[model samples]
Target: MPKEIAGPEVTPGARETQLGEWRIVALKDASFALDGGAMFGVVPRVMWERLTKVNSDHTVPLATTPYLLDNGTYRVLIEPGMGLRWGEKQTAMFHISHDEGHELVTSLRAAGVEPEEITHCLMSHCHWDHIGAACGADGLPVFPKAQHWCPQSERDAALHPDHLRRASYRKEDLQPIIEANLLQTFEGETEILPGLKMVELGGHSDGISLVILETAEGKAAFWADIVPTSNHVHLPFIMAYDMNAALSWEVRTKWIPLAAEEGWLNLLYHDLDQPMGRFVVDAKKRYTFAAI
Candidate 1:
């Protein structure tokens, strides 16, 4: 049985705020080492290191593989964490460990969900770590029935990537899904199901996407690696992993208000301590993380 990890705690006597009615699930909770300088963009180490735990090697600890649920009809998985394909060198560099079963199959099974149960397999982008588990050990579609969605431009970039971007696109990790004829490309905003919508956010990676779920309570936007963690809520805390830093800032500026004004619960893919939360703007117009 999958052990239940504690959800974010609510203060005593605090009224329950219904951001949305979806049944959210945390699939896998793990960490990755990212260069501290890259994680904070232009922010100096002095300011960024205080918010995250940085090792002597200057890598920041960020969460991996968190997902959500929407009324049973839709099972949207944001990013599948680093999978089993990494060799010793890569593994050691990223400090990858299989002890927690961060494997997508294990996490999904633990949640009582089979691959086929996932109606839509959303990609934050095609970075090897994010989409590694989209295919299995052998080259085949992990989710046989689900459509692997990405923006048209990004799909093109992945297929015919420039030399600079090619490093992140591991052929072994994605070829199986492509050969299986399971990849589905989309442009702009797309509604995969009744209440589930995919929004295009380009920055961290090409064709980066986020899932927005509308329910009786309100709406929830799964911000995959865009606002990767609670620490990244600030506008300038862009990732070094992003291809276009300026564009990332543009996307974040636009989405922050849309989330707060519309009361969209912000679901994060890599916030180790608090994976999901709502964005609140205080009197000073600064954003604060309200754990859900």
Candidate 2:
């Protein structure tokens, strides 16, 4: 029998109290290091580090929680985790390890859904960590029967990656899916599945994507890597991992309100502590974390 990878226990929050008919499954839990100065953008590390502890190596912990929406017909997986493709140097640099089985296949099976059953495998972006699990050990498409959806611009960028981003775009990670003919490229807002929409926002990476799930309760936006954690909910908490910080700020400003007003569940991809939550306007009218 495979060992179970423990996920963070859910705490009672506003969403559960109000919206009652949604189910969430944590796909994988993993971490990586990012420079402290870069992670906070212009903000001083003195201020930002106070909120969350940074490792000695300076990279903060990241999680990949791929939500499974079984709306009867569709079984969708939002961004899969960084898979087992790290070399020694990469592993040492990022401190990547999978003792608890960071395998999405195992996690999904435990959740009662098979890889072939997945209707859509949404690539939130082309970042190595975000898209690593999209392919498998043999460098082939992991989800054979599912359509791998990514933005057209992202696909183009991946094919002709720049010197700075080249290292992150490994052929082993993406080529198999392309060869398998499972890659389905999309432009702006497109509905790959009924009630599930892809919102195109380009800042963190070129043509970064977000998934919107229309549930019986309400709409939930799987904001991949944008607001990676609950701590990043603040407008100024832009990641150093983002290539274009200015554009990332712009996207956040626009989406934060849409999240607050409609009470949309902000599904964070790498928040170790608070994986999923709803944005709230506090007493001072600033956006804050209201975990679900």
Candidate 3:
């Protein structure tokens, strides 16, 4: 497990570590809850309810975690986070909670980073929660100086979502990036930076992608929503929110083992308890996690 910046005694707050030449910092934008049934897909409530606290509304708490990778020159931010544009209804529905200054930029500034310093903004997908902070309430790109990137499909989905995915994407959240000419889109897999790449996997959404960073230290993966939290580690534990459960299973089957065997430092996006850990496969071939 990577050491917490505040020391071992501190359990909550941002975590920082050095991965090869990059300085990685995990920042929390907001704490919210999602429908438990929607989150566990085909898994029985009996199996998952015991793993985490469930609110009276049957929602499971989750954190919107955005990671900042800095190596003096380029500062790349992954996952823009659920910004503060929700209305009363949406806020109440999600049980969103955060301190006064809880937006991604606020969290970035708290970590000694200003919005302008961000060189690139990477997206695993443009689901509202993952890309909400890309723009501000005034409909402008928040990180004006950063070149925002995502799969070409995600950009299309965000701009013109079908009935099924309409709610997951908000045009206002991504339009400004396009208008500002800051949005960069790719297909299949592309390395946006040296040692950093985004691989598109459409299981979660039409064009959702996963990020990979490799260096002398090792490989690190950002498992956006595929294996959202540590609890979703089971092979069958796909999320109902996924666009294609079968594809999600296949993706999980392939990557989970590779991550375990290769000893990649896995960064989770929605886990509330622990965001960073390494996959561990025991003799029985069952997978588990060892916190970093």
User: How do all models score by TM-score?
Assistant: 0.88, 0.89, 0.94
TM-score winner between 1 and 2, please give it.
2
Residue-level lDDT tens digits of model 3 in 231-281: 887677889999988898889899998887777877889998687877777
Q: Write the per-residue lDDT of candidate 2 for residues 1-292, one digit (tens) a residue.
A: 0022122223643211222343566666356656667667777878888877788877665556676766557677888778877789988888776657566788788878898998778887777878888877777777888888889888877788888778656656677889889898888889986678898898888899888877666777788877877877878888776788899999999988678777776777777657667777766657777764
Pairs clashing within candidate 2 = 33-59, 34-59, 38-240, 63-270
Which ten contiguous residues of candidate 1 have the minimum total lDDT?
A: 1-10
**Model 1 lDDT on a 0 to 1 scale:** 0.71
Identify the superior model by lDDT, candidate 1 or candidate 2: 2
Question: How well does model 3 score by local distance difference test?
Answer: 0.85
Candidate 1: the clashing residue pairs are: 38-240
As a whole number from 0 to 100, the lDDT of residue 138 in candidate 2 is 71
Off-target runs (Cα >4 Å) in candidate 2 are 1-22
> What digit string (tens of lDDT, one per residue) describes model 1 on residues 1-292?
0022123333322222233445667677345677789778788888887787888888877667657474556776666666667678977787766666666788888877888888777776777767777777665677888777767766666677898888777766666777778777788788877788788878877778878877776677778778887888767778877898888889989998678666566777776667666677776777767763
lDDT of 2 at 15: 16
On a 0 to 1 TM-score scale, where does candidate 1 land against the true structure? 0.88
**TM-score, ranked from best to worst:** 3, 2, 1
